[model samples]
Structures are given as C-alpha cells and as structure tokens.
Target: MEKFTRLTSVAAPLAEADVDTDIIFPARFLLLLDKAGLGKHLFHERRHRRDGGMTDFVLNTPPFNEARILVADANFGSGSSREQAVWALADFGIRCVIAPSFGEIFFSNCFKNGVLPIVITGEAHANVMAAARTGQPFTVDLEAQTVLLPNGPALSFDIDPWRKRALLLGLDEIGGILADDAEDISAFEARHRVDNPWLFLDDGRMEQLLSQGDGK
Candidate 1:
C-alpha cells in the first residue's frame, strides 16, 4: 500500500455521471488477477477505438495521460463492486478523486487502495470540474481534509478519521489492526504461549510427539 498525504497535479475531468465500476475496469478484464499494469486498461473502451487503436479520450492525451487527480461528476464509481476499478485508478497514478457522490463499495475501496476519494457538491463540484478541464494542477491534502482548486480557495471535504489515518500511514485493514495493537498482540502472544505451551510446539517437540504417537 502507498501513503496518500497530499497530491498537487493536473486532474483529468471525467464529466460523465454514474461512471460505474464495470466501465472503469470492464467485466472482460475481470479475469486479470494481478493489479500491476492495470493502468493500460483503465477506461479501455472509452480510450480505444473499435479497431483497437487509441482514441482522443482525456486520459489518452498529453498532460491528462500523466494525471494524478481526477474530478468526476455525480455518482461516479457506481455499479457492481469491483475493487480493480480503484486499482486501475491507483495504477494509473490517480491518488485523489473528486466527485459529488460515489458508490458505497467504490468509496470504501479507495481508502484501502491508498486513493483519496473526496465528495463535494453544488458550486464546489462545478468549480473543481471546471478547473480539472483546464488541465491545471489541483491539490488534495488528506491531512488538512481540503482540496485546493486551481483558481479558487481550498474547499473542505469530510472523511472518516479512521480512514484518513489509514491512508496517511499506507495501511490496509490488517496492517491497521497490527499497527494499532502491536504491543497488545505481542503481550497476548507471550501470555498465551505460557498458558498453552503445547500450542507453541517447535520442531523438536513436534517430532517427539510424533514418535511417541507412532510407538503408541
């Protein structure tokens, strides 16, 4: 996992509403197990022609091709839960996404994958989208919970404190658990081993037990 503290870069504007997971990663590519190299397939259909050539999609062009932020329309990332959608965005160097609303699962997945998904509505959303269209650098700071638009003042966004911490530390759920309870876990293991030494069998103890069982 990668930590997402702040991102200041040109944002690719995806004005389409309800851009679903299936469209982001595509069902056909679901068979791909590895998350690496998923950037090539992001928005596959939209970025490709019927003849398998490149289209003039925003991401296929200059500046946007190297975009690290995305400003999308309402209901972005809606549809079936496919974590690869977030993976694709992350693999493509998108560390932050701004939208009016997001799919419940997709929004959750973003935090797990080290991508900051920000929700802004009304004039703020419109302004961000407009700035993104101009291919100007937009800054998203997880620490401050703010999005610095190209022209206007930074707009505030809300996020769960826990999720914000996880992203800041580049921790997944299991990593978070380990980090939050490392001392407790170590102390518990020491106590458990003393209480149940049989459960802590080493190679020699296991071999001795096996030999005794065989003799019996």
Candidate 2:
C-alpha cells in the first residue's frame, strides 16, 4: 500500500446518497483477479452508455476525470462488502473520499487499501460539497487531519489513530501487525513450537514417522 500523507488535486462532486458498492464498481467486473487497470472499470455502469459509449457522468467529464478527491453525500459507500470498491477508487487515483457517512465494511476497507474515507457533517460537509463542484484543487493533509478548501477555510476530520498511522506509514492491516507486533508474534511462535513439538518436526522426525507406518 502507498502512503497517503497528503493530496492536493481536483475533486469531483457526486451529491447522490447511498451510492453503494455496485454503483462504484459493478459486480460483473468483480471477476477481475488483477488490480491493474481497474480504474477504467470504476463506475463502469455510470461512465458507459447502453451502446457502450461514454456518458456525461461527472467522472467522465473534464477535470473530474483526474480527480484525486471525491466529495459525496451521506452513505457514500453502502451495500454488500466488497474491497474492490476501494480498489477501484485507489486505482482511479482518488486518495480520499469525503462523505457524511459510509458503509461500515467499506469504511474499514478504505484504510486497508490506502484510501481515506472521511466523515464530516453540518456546514463543513456542505462547504466541501460546494467546493467540489468547482473542480478546483483542494489539499488534504493527513498528518494535519484537515482539508484546505479551494478558497481558504480549512476543515478538520477525525480518524482512528491506528488507522491514521497505518496510512501515513503505507502499511496494510497485516503489515501493520508485523511492524508493530513482530516480537510478540515471534515469541508466541517459539512458545507454540515448544508446547507442540510434533507440529514442527524436523526431517529426521518426519522419516521416523514415515517408517513407523509399519506399526500402523
């Protein structure tokens, strides 16, 4: 995973609520085993027309096409659990998603996949949505936990400290565990091996077991 310390780039506004995982990345494309080129499949249904042409969707238009931040309404990523939704966003170069709320699963998946899903409300969220409409640059400072809008005002958002640390250090969940608890994990494995010696048998032990098949 890549570090998401900060981003200053175009933001696209998608004011719709309950956008859902399917809308973000169609299920049919879920068959894709590779993460590469998933960007072209992001919002596949919305970006394509019935005849397989490009629609006038916000993401297909100028400036928005290169968006690094996505400003959306409440419940931005709802529906079934699909980590691919976050994958699509990341592949599309969107580092952050600003929404009033997000699906519980999607929210967690974002952090694991190097995408920041921020929750904001009240006037601040309204201001963000308004700023996104302009297709101008907005700066998101992960270390500062603030978003500097196009004009001037900066808004702060909250994130779990551990998740924030992982994002800053470019560590996924397993990577975080190894980085933080490698010693503890090693100690546990050592104890387990001593307690269950048969589970870690050497070549000599394996040969003995194989030869003992005569006693079966």
Candidate 3:
C-alpha cells in the first residue's frame, strides 16, 4: 500500500447518488486476477455504449480524464461488497473519493487499498462538487483531515485514527496488525517453541534424518 499524505489534483464530479460498485468497475472485469490494468475498465458500463463505443461521460473527457480526485454525491459506492471497486479506482490513479456518504463495505475497502474515502457534507460537499465541475484542482490532506477547495474555505472531515495511521504509514490491515503486535508475536513464538518442541524440527534431528536418507 502507498502512503497517502497530501494529494492535490484535478477532481471529477459525479453528482448522481447511489453510484454502485457495478457502475464503477462492472461485473465483466471482475474475472481479472490482478488489480493492475483495471483502470481502463473503470466505469466501463457507463463510459462505453453497448456497441463498445465511448460515451460522453465525464471521465472520458479531457481534463477530467486525468483526474485523481473524485467528488460524488450521497450514497456513493453503494451496492455489492466487491473489493475490485477500490482496486479499479486506485489503478485509475484516483487517490481520494469525496462523498456525503458511502456504503459500509466499500468505505472500508478504500482504506485497505490506500484509497481515501472522505465524508464531506453540507456546504463543504456542495463546494467541492462545484469546484470539481470547473475542473479545478483540490487538495486532500490526510494529516489535517481537511479538503482544501480552490476558492472556498477548507472543509474538515473525520476518519478513524487507526485508519488514518494505517494510510499514513502505508500499512494494510495485515501489515498493521503484525506491526502493532510484533513484540507480542515474537514472545508468543518463543513460548510456543518451548511448549511444543515437537512442532519445530531440531537441527540435530534434521541432520540425522538426512544421514539416514543418504544411507538408504
């Protein structure tokens, strides 16, 4: 996972609410084994017509095509618990998603993949959406927990402290758990070795087994 600190980039606005995971990455691309190369498939169903021709979607346009921040309406990422949704966004170079609300599962997936899902409501949400429409650049400061608009006052947002720390340190859930309890893990391993000697292979025993195999 990459460390997410302060990101300043062009933001694309998708004002529709209830934008689901299927719309973001589609079900067809879900068969992919790896997260890489999914960027081109981001918003596939919406960005392309039935005939496979490109549509006039915001992401398919200039300026917005290079957007790294996405400003969306309420209930963003609402549908199935597909982790690929976050993978598609991250692969597309989108580091942050600003919405009034997000689906619980999708919201959690964002942090796991280094995508910052920000909940900004009321004036701040309106302001950021407005800025995105003009293709203006905005900044998201994970350290400060604020979204800096191009012309308006910075909007503050809240995130779990542990999630923030994990993003800052580029630690995924597994990485965070291991890192947080490294000493305990080491101590447990030491105790386990003493308690269950049969669980480990003794060097002398291994050498004896190898000698027996050679003799056979």
Candidate 4:
C-alpha cells in the first residue's frame, strides 16, 4: 500500500448517498480475480448504459477522470463488505474519500488498504461537492486534516490520531508493527524462543513468528 501523506489532484464529486459496493464495482467484474483494469469498471453501471453507451458519469467527467479525492454523500459504501470496493477505488487512483458517513466494514477496509475515508460535516460535504462541479483540482492534506476547496474556505475534518498518522505515513497494519515496536518485537521473540523451545518447529520458525505477529 502506498503512503497518503498529502494529495493535491482533481476531486470527483459523487453526491449520491447509499452507494453500495455493487454500484462501485458490479458483481460481473468481481469474477475476474485480478485487481488490474478494474478502474475502468469502477462504477460500471453508472458509467455505461444498457445499450452499451456512455452516460457521462461523475468519474467520466473531464479532469475528474484523474481525480484522487472523492467527495460523496452519506452512507457511502453501504451494502456489502466486499474488499473489491476498496480495490476498485485504489486501483482507480482514489486515495481519499470524503463523506458525511460510511459503512463500518467499508471504513475498516479502506484503512487496511491505505485509503483514507474522511468523515466531514454534512454542510462541508455539500460545499465540497458543489465546488467539484467546477472540475478543478483540490488538495487533501492528511497532516493538516484539511480539505482545500476551490472557491470556498478550507474544510476541517476529524480522523483518529492513529489513523491520521497511519495514512500520513502510509503505515498499514504491518507497517505499524515494524514502526511501533521493532526492537521490542525482536527482543520478545528471542526471549520466547529461549523460554519455549518447543515452539520452533524448523528453519521456518522466524518466518512463522513474523507471520503470527502480522495476524495480530
């Protein structure tokens, strides 16, 4: 997962609420096991028509096609707990999603994959969506916890200090372990192996311990 310290790019405005995983990445696309080329399928139904035409979806707009930040309404990613929703967004180069609310499962999945799902006030969300209509670039500063608008004042948001630090430093779960207590971890493993000799099976003992630490 890439770090998301600070981002300044075109922001795609998806004002619709209750955007389920199916709408973000349809079930048909999930049949393919690869995460590649899914960006073209991100919002497949909304971007294409039944007659195999285009419907001018939010993501298909001019500069919005390259948007890194997404401004959306409440209950974003509400339906299923499919990890593909996060995959599609990240594959499409969307680093952050700003909304009034988000599905619990989807929110956790975002952090695990290094995506920042920012929760802002309803009024601020509306303001950002309205500004996105200009199709101009916006900035999301994770360190500052501010969303820079085009024609309006900067919008402030709250992210858990830990998650904010994680996103800013691009530290997913594994990264956190290495950063938070590398020495302590090494020392513990040494002590544990000395105290519990039976735990080590063979040459893969260290690898097994590292994997077990990651599972936490």
- Each candidate's TM vs. the true structure? 0.95, 0.91, 0.94, 0.86
User: Candidate 2, residues 1-216: lDDT per residue as tens digits?
Assistant: 999898998899999999999999999989997888898999998999889899999989998988999999999889989889989899999999999999999999999999999999988999999899988888999999999997867899999999999999999999999999999999999999999998999999899998898785
What number of backbone clashes does candidate 4 have, counting pairs of residues 3 or more apart or in separate chains?
0
Worst 10 residues of 2 by lDDT: 207-216
Give the distance in Å from residue 83's predicted Cα in candidate 4 to where it truly belongs: 0.8
- In the predicted model 2, the residue pairs found to clash are none
What does candidate 4's lDDT look like per residue over 49-92, in tens digits?
89998889878877888888898889999888888999999999
By TM-score, the candidates rank as 1, 3, 2, 4
Q: For each predicted model, how many residue pairs clash, with residues at least 3 apart or on different chains?
A: 0, 0, 0, 0
Residue 49, candidate 2: how far off, in angstroms? 1.0
lDDT of 1 by residue, 82-142 (tens): 9999999999998888999999999999988988999999998999989988887878888
Candidate 3 per-residue lDDT, tens place, 1-216, comes to 999999999999999999999999898888897999999899997898999799999999989999999999999999999999999999999999999999999999999999999998998788889999998888999999999888967789999999999999999999999989999999999999999987797899888888999995
Query: In model 1, where do residues sit more than 4 Å from their true spots?
Result: none
Residue 10, model 3: lDDT of 93
**How many angstroms is residue 26 displaced in model 3 relative to the true structure, after the best TM-score fit?**
1.3
Q: Against the unseen true structure, what C-alpha lDDT does each candidate score?
A: 0.92, 0.92, 0.93, 0.86
